[model samples]
Target: MSTGTLYLIPNTLGDGDEAALAYVLPAPVRERAGTLASYIGENAKTTRAFLKRVGTTRPIQEIEIHELNVNTPAGEIDKLLKPLLGGIDTGLVSEAGVPAVADPGALLVRRAHERGIKVVPLVGPSSILLALMASGLNGQSFAFHGYLPVDANERIKKLRELEQTSRKAKQTQIFIETPYRNKSMLDTLLSTCAPSTLVCVAADLTLPTETILSRAVSDWKKKPTPDLHKRPAIFLLLAH
Candidate 1:
């Protein structure tokens, strides 16, 4: 019997409105998303909402959603792929952006590859890639350090280290913070990075209020710090 494929689905960066969905995701991805009956996601509520927006024909209640998060045990991850082994195609989705890139879905993807199940990644909006495209940074060579330390002092130390690495390797550093902590993160970046270093703050990406600005750290200090509180954003920094 042929094993089922594991579809890596991508969701919107911010509000999953019709316009953003229509603009970033291709027609084929939406169509394929509708056909899946089982899925693994970071959050069930948001997963259902995204499925509805993608025009799923299946009844929302009937769709099977297995939760996968930081707390999910590594051993239990194999069970999440059992449906695929039974010849039922299953999708992996995140609360936002592409699944598995910076999300816990990567664990399931890795297990699928070990089991030799076909894995397919559908085209969708990714705040990281979108920010990099607009940041005009060293996209060819860059690194994504998911999230910095939450402690202010540690965060500052980490920021300085990332800046030093960027300068030494000429590699762009990309990172993010929880929406509620956005302002604090921005403050740390402004205070810690070198004055001449280039920094890009891409907020509310793929949304109507989307903003992408790249400027020298010195310039950012002169203007009012952007109000990023309670908003999703991607921060990019480069020493060159």
Candidate 2:
């Protein structure tokens, strides 16, 4: 009987460097990548370098490709996964942060599970968790609504709805936008949310020059952070 495996990688911790990265990823994942590299005619060094902060490794029989919206048919996921379904090792990685946390790795995971493949989530830094940690808001209850609406008017309407929901639920509301749209998103947030509501902006998280600032919307309205171009960020709303 063969066995399959999935390795969940984490985002960078404080910064994207070897020393800071060492503590954020699972040690076992690093070890496992070494082992897999040996079988696949690849160097563990390169593989390790590619996955410096994703996950610790483990033994498995197969590894499926980890991308999204491929032309492959849904039924074919089973066939392609035959090698790993019984007992293969796989890894899920997002561009930044853990897979499925505003990224597109969930489809592959769901398909894998339908076939009885064992899924292992490796411990690592999560941007959402990091944002919540620094938000200075009610962490006990919160909702991550993924990316906000792209259209301006729709986006503001959604933000208003989210604010109302947050107030009633007494939970923090978290959302994000593509890097280029950060400025627009911030503007809409400022215009839409109440003046007294507490807002947290976490930019370039885990990267050099990371900033986690929490203050009233009115304060930010005066002197806003520079346009968040060229940086990844998450925003949180905590009603007082």
Candidate 3:
């Protein structure tokens, strides 16, 4: 029997407003996802909630939602893919944003390729790209460096290096922080980067509360700090 295709599903940026679902994902993508019987998600509970919004054709309870997160063993990849090998179409759902871009599901995607299973990426919201789009920075060249070091000193050192790289290469450097650490990340960015470097803090993308702030480091210090506390945000910087 032919192996099933692994549908790379994109989850919303945030659950700010349920009414906004209609516009976040295209109708065709949602319709197709609704028909899937199996899914491999970063978090099964959230995946079920997302499918609930899509109004799955079959009862959500009947659908198989398996978890594949940061803690999932690499050796277990093939096991999770057994259903797909049996010709069961499965969706690789991310906790947020597109699957595989900055998500752990990339491993599953690669294994699927080795097994000759088709991989399909559906259109969806990606906070990283969306932030860069509105940041008024160098869109022609950019790089996303997932997360900086958790230690303050290390993160600060990393930020300085990224800014210098952006200055010399004219490339946008992008990264994200846990919701609770958003404010801390912003603080590090403001203090560590050069005064003229362009910094963008895009929060709540695609949600009703979406906010994109892009300005020089000096200018950032002049205005009241945004309430980035506990808010999911994507940070971008470009140096001249």
- Report lDDT (CA) for all predictions: 0.90, 0.69, 0.91
Name the better of 1 and 2 by lDDT.
1
Least well predicted 10-residue stretch by lDDT in candidate 3: 14-23
Supply candidate 3's per-residue lDDT for 172: 97
What is the descending TM-score order? 3, 1, 2
Residue pairs with backbone atoms closer than 3 Å in model 1 (clashes): none
| TM-score, prediction 1 | 0.96
What is residue 159's positional error in candidate 3, in angstroms? 0.8
The TM-scores of all predictions, comma-separated, are 0.96, 0.82, 0.97
| Candidate 2 residue spans exceeding 4 A from truth | 11-15, 37-49, 52-66, 69-76
> 19-39, model 1: which lDDT tens digit per residue?
779888898998999999998
Query: Best TM-score goes to which candidate?
Result: 3
Q: lDDT winner among the candidates?
A: 3
What is the per-residue lDDT of model 3 for residues 1-240, given as tens digits with 9 covering 90 to 100?
Answer: 998889998888877444677677888888889999999998889999999988899999999989999999999999999999999999998888899989999999999999999999999988889999999999999999999999999999999899999999999999989889999899989999999999999998887788899999999999998898888899999998
**What would you estimate as the lDDT of candidate 1?**
0.90
RMSD of each: 1.1, 4.6, 1.1
